[model samples]
Target chain A: MPLGLNFTQIFLHLFNFLLLFAILYFLLYKPVKNFMVHRQEVYRKEAEETSQNLEKSEKARAEYEEKLAQADREIAGLKAKSGEEAQAHYDRQVKAAKDEAEKILRDAREEAERQKAAIVQEAQKDISDLVTDAAEKLALHQSSQENFEKFLDTVEAGRAEAKN
Target chain B: MSKKQQRKMTVIFVVIGVLLLAGIFLTAGASAQEEDIVTVIRDAVIHDTNKIALFGLEVNPGLISGLAVTGILTVFALIVRIFVIPKFTLVPGRFQMILETMVGYFSGLAEDSSPHKNRLLSAYIFAAGLYIFTGTMLELFGIQVVTTAGHSVALPAPLSDINGAIMMGCTSYLFIVVGGILNNGLGGVKGALKEFSLPISMSFRLFGALVSGAIVTELVYYYTALSYVVPVLVGVLFTCLHALIQAYVLTMLVALFYGEVSEPSEKKLRKLAAKAQKTEVRTAEAA
Candidate 1:
């Protein structure tokens, strides 16, 4: 055969090469490729799950922070409102106490003045009675012994009347 | 010139002068009896056909060499499949890294050339690349076998036989045709048919490159004077270059042509245009 070119050799070479190709395809290429693809998919799935979990936690944290901030605002507002109410209540109570104290002092002063006036009227009446007695004694000096006895009897009757 | 350059030039000239003198002496010392150049050429070109009678059928020696290569490849593949591949981890070992790099290189070539048909094409290219690379480099081992005629001969690269190259070329063409049909239907068939000369060109290219290297190496060895240093240089350079370049060339051609033929045609364009129109209408309505 010129340069080893023959139908038989060509056909056999073709057959041998094809057989090798088939063996390699089945043995080496398929399995390694499948393994790589499967590993890639697994890694992708894991990454996705991790990312999703992170996002969920972030959202939950944000919601919690919002609620906490809202709570703080409400507590502050309530504190201010309550503080105003307490101050108003304190002012009203103080004003009421002051007015009541003033009323009590005025009533006490009036009662004390009435008692003083009554005492003074009684003293004046007593002073007028004593003065009349003194004048009667001076005018009765004509009958010495008889005038003295009459004055004594008159003093005793006045005392008895004052006592009654 | 600098001192260093002047010194380098002087050394180069001295080496050349010595080589020329040695050449003249060697030629003068050669025997007067001349060898037949035509006989040497014939011996270089022709491989002995040692036929095996398999069920009353004749088998060629080239085929025998092809079978040996195939057998070696099969056993290697089987070993890797059972022992090496199974033990492969996410972090590759040295041997595994070499295998992965080889597979990855061809796979990347397929993907870059034909993204749509990357799956099928990559597998095919990987198989083809391995076959060519291993088949060519197998000759470097210089394994010889005794034929039925009691004549011992060194096995040649499978592609050194024109039949093997033709087979590979035709097979690659078949893949390209199938890829086209699958991707673009009738248009793909027409496209593939237009490139009918592809198989012929591919076969001749592979066969010619490999045979030329063998012929040159044989010619170098045939000469007594030149055989010592020249055969080593020629054989190594030619074998390595052919093995690598032919493997890359065939795979690249297959991928490039497959990609060209398999690209989607009128129907895909229509679908794209329709989708764009629908989007436009929706946007207008929203506005």
Candidate 2:
């Protein structure tokens, strides 16, 4: 009694404490802690899910960006290729037109040369025939009017042959 | 002034003057009628007189207060478990915030002290801290019960009793020792045994600290003219301070000791983990 030390009271206190402990463990501590744990788990899962979604979107965006870049590069290559092809086609068409024009001019010049040669040969032949006829009329000593008339006829015939 | 108004004014003045005079006389009379300093100190230290007999053993008011603390805590827990717990949201409300702060503090303490295994330890400290805090705060209510001997007794903090303090100390020591033995075998027991004075020191610490605060509060109430207001402050603050300090000290000591003893044996830890994994696999297969 000096220090209020009693075995029975000590046991009662222990019992009372134990009872409170049990009650709190079951009713208060467990459930509240469980709720807190559950909430933490939920938030963690949500955070993880959000992170995964972000990662997926990031990957998709990167892939799309890569595809876009590739497409741009391909389009640039196609444009250059097409432009070169068009240039080549235009050069070919110009060359072909020039060759065709040179061919037409050369053909016209060749035909004119041939015609000049033919006219020259005919004039020479006519001149030769006229000279021969003049000599023969002088050697025969005929009248001057008759010789001149034959010369005129032979010159007219040669002129007509040259015209033809 | 009218005669009626004049009469009312005179009456009000007389009443105010009489109340002032009465207040002075009451304070003076209260200071004059003082009890013995030694007896007050003795009563503060030990409340063994007029003990109640339960199971043929005389029990102190501290024990009764202990019972009351337990009952009150049980009811509060039951209420929180039923009503408040169900309504708890991820984003906490006011009451939830308060509860979380209290519980989280103890849990964090447990985690700091016993890093290896803290779930059970946290629960333990939470219970112990709650009991101590609630028991010490019980005196604030000034709950009184009349005994068969025709004397009214005011219940006080449970640990004010030497027996109750001894109980707390021994319980905590036993808990730590048991934890050590269960976790680390004979080595933990040896470690626990080395701290043989822990129970006695813890018991006296709780008892002395609480008794000293009570004594000073009683001394202030007895010796001072301003006992009415001053003692209220001293009693409340001292009691409250002691409640928080003692609860923290006991739970902290237990956590430290339990943690030291209950650290898993290093050499056997791998084997235990492997065994646990095997069992888990077996269970999964069985399921």
Candidate 3:
């Protein structure tokens, strides 16, 4: 068996490597590790803050959205109620106007009918009085004419008696 | 003619003088105080590195520029008005009037924030806001907050990281305090605190908006390998858009906070009137 490395040489190389490792640990590895740890701490804190901020934003957004929706609902309900009320008001006004118009028309028709009946009754009474008067005048005239003719006959009889 | 009498009067006056001096000295000595007082000013400034990093805290150039300009202008204007204009006030100059008007305007703005109609609050707010804005802009020139491995990190440029934190903290604190005072005065102290919520949101909101816009714009520019002008234009446009959005949001929050306490009475009056009208209508119908 052929040994490529002597024991003393091997041990010396090992010691040299160990020294290098120690120096690297202090100069590069330790500092690097510390820096990385600090950076990580900062990162972790930042992540937590960001997450908290996101949560707050989400909560605020949800609250705002809820308020907006509630306002919309209130507005819609108000409009519907106002519309219903307006419609009711219009209907009531129309009904009152129609009733007033009907009442006025009925009153006018009644007055006209009464006036027409009074006029017809007055005409009939006037016509009947005129016919009665005419009949009385005719009767008087006939009686008077008969009496005059009788008087003329008497005068003729008296003259004949005196001559005898 | 009266030298002996004069001498006697002088002696009496001198005696009174000495007596008065002695009384003054006695009072002064009696009032003298010597006490060893150790006042501890606990300026406990609590800060979180993570919170600062998450917001990508940086210097603001616009704020810094605005402050420098405003300061220079104030000093120049003050010097000119106080010295130069006073020398020529006999002519009733336009410059004097202009100066007066400017002062009056600032005074009025100050009065709005003052506790008892004073200009101190206004002046303080203006100065602080200007300083904060300027410092923020200066910090923005180099400091950047970046996300790596799903965690945010504050990568400082030339300035130290602590300085960056302090700059951002100062800016946020200034805005919060001033806005709180104004809001509180307009509403109440509690309301002011409630109003402070707006600034708290703004602290992060402005940063978030700017960072997101920058990232997107940078990504687009990178992928497109756009020209210098293109990148600059995109960056400016992004910044402007972000600014407009931030302003709108801030305005909305202020208005909302103010409105919460102001609008209810008017609403109540309107409701009462409506109810009265309904009752009147009902009475008329019954009649």
Candidate 4:
């Protein structure tokens, strides 16, 4: 054969290759490929699981956050409500105390005014009596010093009685 | 091992190198007349000198070399299968990483090329890559064998022989056709047959690349003036590069064509049927 191109040798080479291919397929390629594919499947499953877990955690976190936010909003609302109630209560108490204090001052002032009016009336009566005695004394004893002195004594007696 | 020790070793290596060059030149002065360059080149290209008998038939030593490589690869596969593969963990060690990288690359290529159905494609490419790569690397070892006539023959790469290249190319084409048939049926066969030149091109490509490397290396070795360090570089460059490049090329071509032929025929068939129905309706409307 030209260039030593033997058909037998070519077939032999082909057989040799086919044989090698078969051996390597089972021994080398299959095992490695199967392992790699298996590993890939495993890694893919792991990644999927990781992503699923992440999604679950994210959902849970959002739920918790929502709950926490709702609780915070409730706490804020309760705090405002309690604060308004306390203010209302304090205002009512202050108004009641102010009314009580104003009433006490008004009663005391009114009682003082009544007492002054009574004193004024009694003094006016005593003064009127003294004036009448002085007029009579002046008329009976025309310019007598003893009558004037008697009028003075009577005025001093009235003042002393009023002080007592 | 230390910096200083390394420097000393470097100096010693340099001195040895210079001495060797001087020794070679001194000794090669009155060279024994060797075989003609043309004859050597022709023999290297033809695998004529590498003759051996196998099973009562005189055979080219490329067969022996191919068998030896196949045997070595098989034993390695067995060892790795038994010991290394069993110990493979999720987190890869260096050995596991190497195995994974090689296998992973081929698997990915197959999947990308033949997405519809890639198991057979994957196996074929992986096997083909391993074989071609090992076959190419066999030349570097310069393995020798004794024939029945007591002739010692240095085994070159199998693809350096025409028969091996033809087998590889034809086999790849055969796989491509098979993939087509398996996936696309008659339509797949049509697709594969369209690229009829693929086998011839692939065969010549592999053969030319490998034989060229072998021829060039042989040529360099035949000349005393250029053989010293040039041959090693040339041999390594050609052999290793050709091994890697050719292996990738052949596998890629096979996977690409196979994928093309083996594409989901259902999708194309449906589209064609729809187009035909539309044309029929249009013709009826015109009538």
lDDT of each: 0.78, 0.81, 0.44, 0.85
When superposed on Cα atoms, how far off is each prediction in RMSD? 11.0, 9.3, 33.7, 6.8
Q: What is the TM-score of each candidate against the true structure?
A: 0.67, 0.75, 0.26, 0.83
TM value for model 1? 0.67
Scanning candidate 4 chain A in windows of ten residues, the lowest lDDT window is: A128-137
Candidate 4 lDDT tens digits, A17-109: 999999999999999988988899999999999999999999999999999999999999999999999999999999999998899889888
Number of the top-ranking candidate, with TM-score as the measure: 4
lDDT at residue A38 of model 2 (Cα atoms): 95
Fnat of every candidate, listed in order: 0.73, 0.71, 0.00, 0.88
In model 3 chain B, which range of ten residues has the least summed lDDT? B37-46
Each candidate's clash count: 0, 0, 11, 0
**lDDT tens digits by residue: candidate 1, B1-287:** 99999999999999977886687577755744233556544533555444444546565445566788788889988999999888888777898878878878888898899887688898889988888888888777777765565655566677776767778888889889999999888899999999999999998898888778767765665565765556567877778888999999999999999998988787876997899999999999999
Query: Over the stretch B129-227, how does candidate 3's per-residue lDDT look in tens digits?
Result: 333233333323433433322332222211112222223333434434445445444434444455454544554454445445534453443332332
lDDT of 2 by residue, B1-287 (tens): 99999999999999976876677566775544333678657756776445665666667878888888888888898889888988999999999999888888888898899898788788888988998888888877778875445566567688888888888889889988988888888988998999999999988998888777666765775654545456568778878888999999999999999999888877768989999999999999999
Stretches > 4 Å off in candidate 3? A1-4, A114-164, B1-287
Q: Which of 1 and 4 is the better model by lDDT?
A: 4
- Where in model 2 is the C-alpha error above 4 Å? A90-164, B1-25, B30-35, B53-57, B270-287
Q: Give the 10-residue window scoring lowest on summed lDDT in candidate 4 chain B.
A: B27-36
lDDT of 4: 0.85
Best by DockQ: 4
